[model samples]
Target: MKRFIGFIKKEFYHIFRDKRSLFILFGMPIVQVMLFGFAITNEINNVDIAILDHSKDANTKQIIDKISASKYFSIKDFLDNERDIETAFKKGEIKAVLNFEKDFSKKLMTENQATVQILTDATDPNTANTISNYTSSILSSYQELLNKDISIPYQIGVQTRMFYNPELKSVFMFVPGVMTIILMLVSAMMTSISITREKELGTMEILLVSPLKPFQVIVGKVVPYILLSVINAIVIILLSIFVFSMPVEGNLFLLGAETILFIMNALSLGILISTVSASQQTAMMVSLMGLMLPVILLSGFIFPISSMPFPLQVISNIIPARWFIIILKGIMLKGVGLVYLWKETLILVGMTLFFIALSVKKYKIRLE
Candidate 1:
């Protein structure tokens, strides 16, 4: 009984002495819950939009006001010509554009019909589609108001054109998400476990004392995983294309490049995790519990971020997988190049750099 008690005490001391293990045991849950509970959302709000009102009459003004006043849209600018719509979308100033045909009131009253065009940047097909639906609902309400007092029937024809994804395939949405999960699991989880296994076997110290620099050692450990992740990404993409008939509308080279960036980001994250986990078991646990759940729930893979509570929406912005998925959907469905997805690309790049820097700093601290 005395020996068993002493053994338990020694184990507790060892766990407390290892800062990384203690953090994994205690700190990881707090971070995971905050990320999961706060970052997973499915609501959209304050979507930026541009309006082209050829009929600058009272009725047109009323409809525009309704759209602007709604929580779903913020009118950024009123354009003069149709040529500017593409420019605004490319500039990332607006997600949608409203085009009211000329003499809208005249057509509504005399001809008993009016036309309005809703053009959305379909790079993010789901968001673009949602914005269009909101806009249509607003216009429908206005139409009802205009006909409320009259026996004569009138209709507002909303011509909605979803650019990039005309059909809005559900497969278009999931391919990117699947790619993100696969890469995250393959790169981060695998690399962390591989590196930590060496520590568990007491081989890490021998490698640390060898001729290889810390960065070199980390790179060597991650490179094979990176290659495997790339292969996995390719396989997923091929399946999406051939089996699901998903379109690779954007530049294939760009898609490949972005996949590589995402894999690298995952690898850096794995290295950071490995630095904090002392054993293979700890690494696997952290990778699965601490990393996987957040990646799955917070990355906008299974749930729409806008639909979540506001706090969760804000937190979802920090997940690397969320940005990578956006980039993938843009390239795959919308055929958007770097011009459209540069922001997401830069975000992934920044996350990769941040993780690598953190891992380097933590490695230095441990060596000291």
Candidate 2:
């Protein structure tokens, strides 16, 4: 019993002595708990939506006030024409649009019922579905409130129109996310590991001493992975279009250009990771474990960003995958082009340049 106790104590000491292992043991759990707790949530909040009030009366205003007052949605703009709903959705300004029938108050008072059209941008099926459900709930609550006062037989007929993904196919949502994850895993993780492998094998020093510039060496190492990532992206797109019958509404050339830009961004991130990690094992762990979760969770791939707490939503702004997913949804689902997606494209470009610059500085410091 004494020998066993001593052996256990020694193992504990060994574990405590290893900082990396200790961090992985204790710190990783805390980090993961915080991420899953804070970042991963199903509760929708502050969803950007628009309103088309054909009947701008007391009842319609009351419904609008109730919707705006709810934590689930934020009214962005009061649209004029029914025609503007599609334009607003394409511009990525709103997730859902609420349209009230003309003479809403009169019908509710005399006919005892009124119609409310809930049009959602269903590129993100989960969010769209949630928004529809929440809108219905709110309208139901409003009806209850009205009944409490006068026991009116008024009904709110909700006509939900899920645009882009009318059938709410899960494949429509997953393909873009799968492409983002695969490209990230392949381009960033593989490039980092490949670069660190050269360093681990002592070949990096030889490359440094060679006539090839460090940037040239880094570019040469990453070019293969870039090509692979591009090929993988093309395959994912083809599969989405052919297998899933997913529509590509936007310009194909623009999508290809954006894919190349994102690949370059991910490659820069990999190069930065390689500069920080001394060995291939470290690079692999950092890329696979560190980068993977954020790409999956915080990027709004699985969880709706609006549904997450404010802090997580703010943090998600830094994730490259988040922007890419938005771009993908915009182009693939909304048929939006550069005019609608230029902001996200510029963000990716900025991030790529920042990573490349940081990596270059780190590489120069290592040489010194």
Among these predictions, the greatest TM-score belongs to 2
lDDT per residue for candidate 2 within 7-115, as digits (tens), equals 3454445445757644543344334433443454455779999999999999999999999999889999999998899999999989999999999999999999999
Superposed by TM-score, candidate 2 places the C-alpha of residue 197 at a distance from the truth, in angstroms, of 0.7
Candidate 2: worst 10 consecutive residues by lDDT?
29-38
Each candidate's lDDT (Cα)? 0.78, 0.81
Alpha-carbon shift of residue 224 in model 1 (angstroms): 1.3
How many residue pairs clash per model?
Answer: 10, 0
Among all candidates shown, the one with the greatest lDDT: 2
Identify the runs in model 1 with alpha carbons over 4 angstroms from their true place: 1-152, 160-163, 364-368
* Model 2 segments more than 4 A misplaced: 1-154, 364-368
Which residue window of length 10 is worst by lDDT in model 1?
A: 29-38
For all predicted structures, in order, the TM-scores are 0.58, 0.60
Residue 46 miss distance in model 2 (angstroms): 34
Tens-place lDDT per residue, model 1, 107-217, is 987898889999999998888878878888888888778768877548566687877767655556666776676677667876787678668777677767666567766
